[model samples]
Target: MALRPNPTLRQRRLGSELRRMREQAGLGGSELARRLGIGPAQMTQMEQARIGVSPERLRMVASACGCSNEPLIDALARMTSERGKGWWEEYRGVLTVDFLEVAELEAHAERITFCTTAYIPGLLQTPAYASAVFARLFPPLPPREIETRTEFRIRRQELIRSGGTPLHTFIHEAALRMQFGGPSVLLDQLRALLDDSERPGISVRIVPFAVDTFPGAGENLTFANGPVAELDTVEVDVSQGALFLESPTDLANHRAIFSRLDATALAEKESRDFIRSIMKEVESSNA
Candidate 1:
């Protein structure tokens, strides 16, 4: 009924799908609005996610648009009502919006493939490790700000362990030994990685120095597969903010990047052994 100032990423995605369906069906804005008994302005608002669309209305739209994929239609229906805000909503004004969107994507993603070269995967970082990583910001953040970010990151990890989404994370070996928060912190972080690697629906791989060469900085990203292939999203974090890529070309390119990284990475078992070896080295150094 009321307009939203900022729709969540999921809501925008639902809107995007409706637009895609209309386009794929070769329906025009005015014609679709005519068929659905809505004004072009309202159609624009609904398709832009500025206004909410009911599940009934969403189904009506899909039916009018000729999108017949049942599973996708069902997924789209679920997005129509994003009842109850997610945990990330708590930080709406407290943190940057882009980061919150990234978290929301992670939460609803059916499958996620993350490729990192410098930093440990956010979903896999320990509080201390995340704190240390967050501490290195260029302009620097206040202690309270850092604490907020650390908490947000820790919360993001819950989605992976929640038993539905599958995670395939590729980390550069250098990240395992970066000594963030000091030797003890990094040691604990690596041990945490070892523990997480063994979890169901979670796959952690390492791109070791032995790989020699692989994708460069441009490839560092998180590709979150929505309920369906067409809805997939790619997120790239930068110093200033995060970039959310949803165009078909962007998704395809990032998917290719992940495939290469996946191939370059050591097998899951070997990756754990690799992490264990690094942890032992850190442990021995402290002893």
Candidate 2:
């Protein structure tokens, strides 16, 4: 097969995990290639995600690496077996890769947790608010680009609306009051948030300004729980774009940060009340 020019994050992660398995078994690429009856370069391509790995090949590699963790090996095999194209692929060339990868990550996530300080989480954003947020980009995007991004974002929210995956989001009071599109837009957004908070599989909590301490240094992050803990991933929103984190250390740290934010935020019922209060304020201000 021809080598992939730009492998998706999931593809790269599979390669990384394969490499990790080899390293843990203290085997060099050449040695593994010899054992697997393939050329060293072929092994390198597989490990680099430039080429695909069949389930049989993946199991063979796991056996060679002395990896007895059946659950992990099964998960890897499933990853290798996935052949369906995701909905995000439709926007592949039109939007940035980060957007597509983020959607992919959420689609595969068994559970998702989001923490934000300044802006509403994408999975919970209204179309008007998302369009407004995109409109204010530093290097302003063209009108067409803004519309595309807003549409993509609204599409992403389908994962939440499906209620198949559990979602827990922590938003700071500051984000609730940002008025991205305008007071009217933010009001609609907040009301939508309130409605979503009551959903069976969704949890929305607010971190009030009255809180004595806040964590995560005010960063916006999404932690996606994988089928297995080792497969978990985190996406941090930065000025450049979405940064995906998967190393054991990065996963642990972000998980801890989410825990801290969870503890600091108000309970679900209280958060709903808080949002209602904010809606009233927005209405009064507009009046």
Candidate 3:
């Protein structure tokens, strides 16, 4: 049989700590498990992150392994607690794991930045606009499924409201010009953008077509800032799929690109005026 790939982020973190504990004690998996009074397989599972390790179990294991690190145990406990069912759990059966992970990450992110080159980013999309986009991508989906996805999208947008830290979007001028649902729907969406742009926490910068080249112009990117002290993560959307990056070097690269994009984008007041210009054109077409 082919060997499976390495574990995920949360898994790898947990596994690394467990492996360190075993190494410190100079004990292999079976030896450590024997000392901990658990089956070797169980201990192996914990180290591989194939199974969830409770705070109590982790503490006991650490103790048996001759490791008494309170801070490490506490961190593992927090991870265990956070592994409980999240708001995205309901969509697990239907949505891909990749999509689910993104949703969960977004929920926990203290701040998010998105650069869109095509359609409006999900957090900024109107219901009508979202519906149109989803329909095109999921042509055979039933109306109910479409509604469910739309509702989820709307719920996701709640993260950007005044009640919470808002999502910052750097929208390209081309996205504002594209009428997804129709001219009327696009008009309403732009009007919503105008109103939302006034929000203090929410920053919307428009990258004009006339502006010189920038990194975001070629691709889309999402940055999910971790807890205050933790390093941030950057996800670059590619044609194949979304790539989650956590390396310090990659994160720094994306941060720099975002700064450059911000510099190239229109100033706040200018962006609002540009949005107004498009809104006016929408009105003219309607009239």
| Per-model C-alpha RMSD | 2.0, 1.2, 5.3
Which TM-score value belongs to model 3? 0.76
lDDT of each: 0.86, 0.92, 0.78
Best by TM-score: 2
lDDT of 2 by residue, 84-201 (tens): 8899999989999999999999999999999898888888889999999999888889999999999999999898898899999999999999989899889889988988899999
Stretches of candidate 3 off by over 4 Å are 1-48, 53-77, 138-140, 228-230, 239-241
For model 3, where is the 10-residue window of minimal lDDT? 1-10
Name the better of 2 and 3 by lDDT.
2
Off by over 4 Å in 1: 280-287
lDDT of 2 at 186: 94
Worst 10-residue lDDT window, candidate 1: 211-220
Candidate 1 collision pairs: none
In angstroms, the error of model 1 at 254 is 2.3
Better-scoring candidate (lDDT), 1 or 2: 2
